[model samples]
Structure formats: structure tokens, C-alpha cells
Target: AQSVTQLDSHVSVSEGTPVLLRCNYSSSYSPSLFWYVQHPNKGLQLLLKYTSAATLVKGINGFEAEFKKSETSFHLTKPSAHMSDAAEYFCVVSGSAGQFYFGTGTSLTVIP
Candidate 1:
């Protein structure tokens, strides 16, 4: 079975500081990993995807993650936080049905 586990249900950050959110995944086969960001009342946008080709991947909005096979983890990081970055993030693992299973959701709060 392919599954994704996010270490945090919520993450709070201050404006201009670094942001880190943790995620771990498990899959029977080689996996496809994705990070998606959802703003308020908006649809999800693909942040990045690791398609078994890259160990380290970069995404939109200055976000990035490294796919660690040993640790079974893909953690998202950003150098600086912006108010616009305050949104819900989801860790996803691609499944057999051409679908992606999402984390419960991570709410990012940006303190001014």
C-alpha cells in the first residue's frame, strides 16, 4: 500500500523566517511524491513532484524537498516565509488509480 504521513497537522511561522514541514511516505513500488499548497477557498496547486528520477526537487514559491529513501521522508522547506504563504499544505503519495492521497492537512499560520 502507498501512504503518506505528515508529521505535523499545523505549522506556525513568522514572516521572513524559514519554514519547515515534515512528511513521510510508504509505498510498495517506486513512488511518486508531491507537495501541494492550497490557499483559502482556492484549489490545490502543485508545488513539486519527485518522480523517481530526482532525489532533490525544487518547486514553486521558493519551496523544495529532498526525497530520502533511507528515511522514507520528504520534507518541505522554504528560506523565508511570506504572508501569502499562509495556507494549507498537503503531502501526497501517488496511488494506483491515477490518484493522490493527501495528508489530513497542514495549516500554516504566519505571524507578522
Candidate 2:
């Protein structure tokens, strides 16, 4: 079985501040991890993905995540927060069976 967990349901940050969205996962075997973001009234878009390639994966909008197998974590981070970055982020994990598990989601609030 595979599962995805987003530690924070909501996160607030001021403009120019660093952003961190924690995510942990569990799987019976090596799992593929992905981060998706949904802006207001917009469709979900892939932020990044980890598919057993480089441990450190970079995504759009200056976002990146490191796959730590020992810790079973793939936390997302950004050097700075922008007003446009405010949105709902989802952490997803997929198993070899082609089944995908999604986290509840984390709402990011960017304050000026």
C-alpha cells in the first residue's frame, strides 16, 4: 500500500520569505512522488516529480524537493514566496500498480 501525507493543511508566509511544505510518504516498494499546485479557479499542474532519478528534483516557480529515502520524505521548498504562489498544493504518491494516493492538500497564503 502507498500513502501520501501533507503535514500542514495551511501555511502562511510573507512576500520574499522562504516557503516550505512538508510531505511524507509510505509505500510497499519504490514509489514515485509528485507535487501539484492548483491556483484559484485553475486546474492542477505538476510542480515536480521524483521517479528514482536524481535525489534532488527542481520544479517550476523556483521550487525544489529532495527525495530522502532514509527519512521517507520529499519536502517541497522555495527560496521566496510570491503573491502568485498562493494556492493549494497537493502531495501525491504512486505505486507500481499504477494507483495514486493524494494528500488532503496544503493551502499556501502569501501575505504582502
Candidate 3:
């Protein structure tokens, strides 16, 4: 079984500052992890993914995440925050059985 937990339900960041969204997962085997962002009334977009190929994965909008097997964590980060970055983020984990587990979600607010 695989499960994902998003430690924060909301995150606030100032424009031009950095952003961080914490996530943790549990699985019997090596799991596939991903981050997706959903803008208001828009579809979800893949932010980054970890599929055993690379420990550090980068995605759109200067976002990135590091897979830490020891800690069972895949936390997302951005160098600078933008107002347009305000959105809902989800942390997902897939187990070997092909079942997907999603975190409740984290609403990010970028303040001017």
C-alpha cells in the first residue's frame, strides 16, 4: 500500500521569496511520486515527478523536488514566488499495484 500526506493545508509566500511545500509517503516498495498544481478553474498540471531515475527532479515554473528514500519524503520548492503561482498543489504516490494515493491538497497563496 502507498499513501501520501501533505503536511500543510495552506502555504503563504511573499512575491520574490522562496516557496516550500512538504510531502511524505509510505509504500511497501519503491513508489512513484509526483506533484501537481491546479490553478483556479484550470486542470491539474504536473509540477515534477520521481520515478527512480533521478533523486532530484525539476519541472515547470522553476519548481523542483528531491526524493529522499530514507526519509520517505518528496518536498517541492521554488527559488522565487510569483503571484501567478497561487494555486492548489497535490502530492501523489503510486504503488507497485498501480494504485494512486493523493494528499488532501495544499493551497498556496502568493502575496504581493
TM value for model 1: 0.95
Estimate, for each residue in 1-112, the C-alpha lDDT of model 2 and write its tens digit. Answer: 8999899999999999999999999998888999999998999999999978699999999999999999999999999999999999999999787888999999999999
lDDT of each: 0.92, 0.95, 0.94
lDDT of 3 by residue, 1-112 (tens): 7889999999999999999999999999888899999999999899988978889999998999999999999999999999999999999998787778999999999999
**What is the per-residue lDDT of model 1 for residues 1-112, given as tens digits with 9 covering 90 to 100?**
8888999999999999999999999888778899999999999999999977789899999999999999999999999999999999999999887888787778899999
Best candidate according to TM-score: 2
Off by over 4 Å in 2: none
What does candidate 2 score on TM?
A: 0.97
lDDT ranking, high to low: 2, 3, 1
- Please give the range of 10 consecutive residues that has the lowest summed lDDT in model 1: 96-105
Output the number of the lDDT-best candidate: 2
**Would you list the clashing residue pairs of candidate 2?**
none
The deviation in Å at residue 2 for candidate 1 is: 0.9
